[model samples]
Target: MPFTGQLEDGRPFIATLALQAHGTGVVGDGKQLKFWIDPWLSTEPLKYKFPSLFCLEQDKRCNVADRIPDCNGSHAVCWNWKHYPATEMEIEELIQCHRLLSNVSLSKQVDRWVWRQEDGDGYSVKDARNWIKGEVLSVNNSVYQWCKWIPNKCNIFMWRASLNRIPTKDALLHRNIYVENGLCGLCGEVEESVDHLFSGCRFASGMWDAIASWCNIPRFYVFSLSDVLLVLNDLPYTAKKKDIMYGIIIIACWRIWKARNDKIFNGSVSSVTLLVADVKSLAFLWFKCRHKEGCIDWRNWCNFVLPVM
Candidate 1:
């Protein structure tokens, strides 16, 4: 989280986004924790999971203890809804809410917060820093090195493309969206799947060939998007050169996607020479501006020469 605002007494204030995300409150008395806002019952707060119910809830600031009433010896869950649940979805959410509360058992001990990310109840600055930096391992088990030199939009696009999450023609078709033709917008040879668009398509292949020649690297005959991303890893180059190549590759991919969109939406023609030139100039601009050690001359950059580190 960003340390932005100052306190009332003029001290710097640290944002609690990390705290609220990783902090899991253990309900004991439940009086101190807000039922809808606090993540006591699950990893996510009920407000996010049950938005319909939260919206209908009359007492927005009601605590867990306020929502759950004591019935003689046992505790019964109660909701202070402004209006009764009318929609089927809302009714289902209400039922699920009750089911979530049915297994919860309150204790006499005071409610406490625990860091859900780590093993112990205590929070660690190292862990928080890692979480903030997005250093945590991916759920898909794919190790993607986020290029710091490139723009975040490029990195994000590459990440999504790596995960096959981008809305390619084939992806749109799979999602039941109507498409006159599912062939690649760039080449129109085969179906526009993630792999084909970024790697297998004739347009993408030419782009990669030109880039490889320009970068003084071996031709990357990739079959999938993963191959395109991991090609730099196998290259016999220094870490710094690999970093530069990775950023260039990401920019190329971003430009390819933009070209495809322009073709489909704006009737723009895709050109290999123009596209490669755009990639080279953009990669040069973004790298020189964003990277700390980016003092390479434009002439050397045009010739793909890396200054000795």
Candidate 2:
């Protein structure tokens, strides 16, 4: 028989207990903890919170004391940021982190680790168990938005495509893998990055335009994967219709990828009309199988008029 008690497994049980029982508490003396690796302010280490800044740092293992400035015999603390932010998002995050840390005052007391998840700042097995339970139940629900109306494999493909993890020519080049050329297979113009292959290329842009017109949506342009994902968010349609539209967009992306591969490997090119028809057919099949409440037919699907909810 299998174990079924609260402390059922030994390895995971001890690991969870250890994680909840220890948290670094910073007293701002800057001597005992690292600036990047220690969990001083937030639950996560500063390295994760400020990844861009951490990457540009010359010294990866520098401690907090090394970055703090001594202000003329006073207890005031100042950050000596060694590197500048590289992008707009990085600049905003860096400013926020600087403002948060600059407010801290250095003390003579040494920094120490404490059990922050428990009451009275002490460790308890019961507290650790409860903390683990809470964390397990808290999911990043936004992930479901990517996989909602598509098949499992297509959803996984979309997720990887969004992250630029697909083995496209440009992605291979970025990983130091040598390729003959980086031009897009579909358009044969410009380097085939994730954004360019999906939206920036003329071929892909034309497909998006056809899709928008078919769905009766206004003529909108897609510049990146983020734009594709967020295009249906604020549309003027019912929730069910929006779900169908989302499915169509996902199918269109898959079809574009398929057509690109077919052209490269099989020396065959599909026209825009045929590609749009494939998207409509596949989307109709998926929506019909997945959404049972909506009574839809082939004519309504082809015309993009979803039945009343």
Candidate 3:
């Protein structure tokens, strides 16, 4: 093809072709040479001319006094017409160093390289105790990361309880630790534990009865806090609803503990109605939404319990 044929696509290619058309001197050898390939200029020749064209119109900063020695970013030129594109081998070296590779492939390489890094016994001693009590689990890695990114109030006490290896049963016992009478303070039974106090004991049973009727939750379903957690975990597709339900569980536990504290320390022996009211209030404060079970707003929350107590 004639030099002009290829020039139609790009100015740099055209410029290189034009140089080839007018070639006279050999690059190194004195033997007669035909039109030569300036590899550097052939690759994006228009880009090569741009900065000088820019320099011509804008401030002519290079005061043409000294021979502008060719380095890297700065250009090498003797006068306006002197011809030199960055060297072909030099450009190739630069291109090699640059290296535009795909992220997918790179990450795959990294993932394959790491075998045992993700292997057995992922838990440290710190997280091990919690692993036993059902707090820490490998499946919840993402959840734990997100939880730490934005601090959760529950995580601190929960983790402290975790580190102390506080058995859920033991912590539940501590809920009534201040009760000096040794017997069940609420129902006058044996020493309290998590299962006994919250599940079987009469005190919490009364609270659950009121809660069940208020929410229209089945009487059979009014079980322990773990059962409540199972319900929350199994909540239907809505994330907002699930979070609110979880908050309800937290508030319920807190309110139950507060009732225990009131009986022991405060001497504020309130009715079950008051306790249920506190639960609803705390739920609203925590979740910022009126928690309702079956289209009934927990508005007159006190009314939910007054009759049951």
Candidate 4:
């Protein structure tokens, strides 16, 4: 039986452990498995993979056992698709799923969960721990590449901005929040989206140009926030230089966001000159405080020579 809160104060931990264990677990039989919720074939749950079909399902809690209908003479298993497709896309998806599952043959064996992480296909605490550790490292490497060097606040801002999670006008609108207008505050011609607010706006484009010139880097295109976050990776620079560039990029994003908020809340305006100056100042302060390898003066920072020395 599942542990209740009254019975187990540590139920949450057990739940988390089940989630972690489920990542490496695969289905051996169709019985005792919810058709929609179980991760039988793919890493994603079936409900997520086939949302339209799942929505049309009469029994949302129906298991795989209920879907497999017995054949007349042959001992073959067949799927009973009880739900109808609502759209052409859903129809195509259903056909695809049907083709994929057509080859899966069921046996009289009992339902069992097998761990894919272990060599013997058995669950082990060590294997689960290693799998969870690897998952954490993979997520951290992709999302927090520059978090260790930059300030937490700045890193978080950049992270959210890059993922387009900030409550921008467009984002709010998408979430069913009504706004008077969606035009960018800096450049009123374009929509105030994450890409436009940071990279596509004329004002933002000018700021990028100024930053590039100040950093002594050649002209480069920044079509989106992803370009800014991943610019250092594509550049042919030393690791130290790349680290400094990463911090500067984060500072620029944070300052741009601040300028946007100021315009929205305080009716203040930001110029390219002011934005570049702030980036330079903030980058210098952050690098000086957080980094201690080399001494960086104001002049070197302004001229973008701090990377060399």
Find the candidate with the highest TM-score and give its number: 1
Prediction RMSDs, each to the true structure: 17.9, 11.9, 32.9, 13.5
Q: Estimate each model's TM-score.
A: 0.55, 0.53, 0.38, 0.53
**Relative to the true structure, how large is the alpha-carbon lDDT of every model?**
0.80, 0.69, 0.39, 0.68
**Best-fitting candidate, scored by lDDT:** 1
Question: Model 2: per-residue lDDT, tens digit, 1-309?
Answer: 111222211224344334433666565567766676667777777777876666555444556776664464453434444456668877877787777676666667776667765355567778666766655454223353664767887787787887678888877877899977888888786777777777766677778889888888887656577678788888788887777777777778878888888988899988788888888888878887877655689998777777753
Q: What number of backbone clashes does candidate 3 have, counting pairs of residues 3 or more apart or in separate chains?
A: 0
Query: Measured by TM-score, how close is model 3 to the native structure?
Result: 0.38
TM-score of 2: 0.53
Q: Considering TM-score, which of the candidate structures 1 and 4 is the better prediction for this target?
A: 1
Per-residue CA lDDT of model 3 for 154-216, tens digit only, reads: 444333322333333344445664434555545555454444445555566666776656655
Candidate 4 CA-lDDT value: 0.68
Ranking by lDDT: 1, 2, 4, 3
In model 1, residue pairs whose N, Cα or C atoms come closer than 3 Å (at least 3 residues apart or on different chains), thus clashing, are: none
> Model 4 reaches what TM-score against the true structure?
0.53
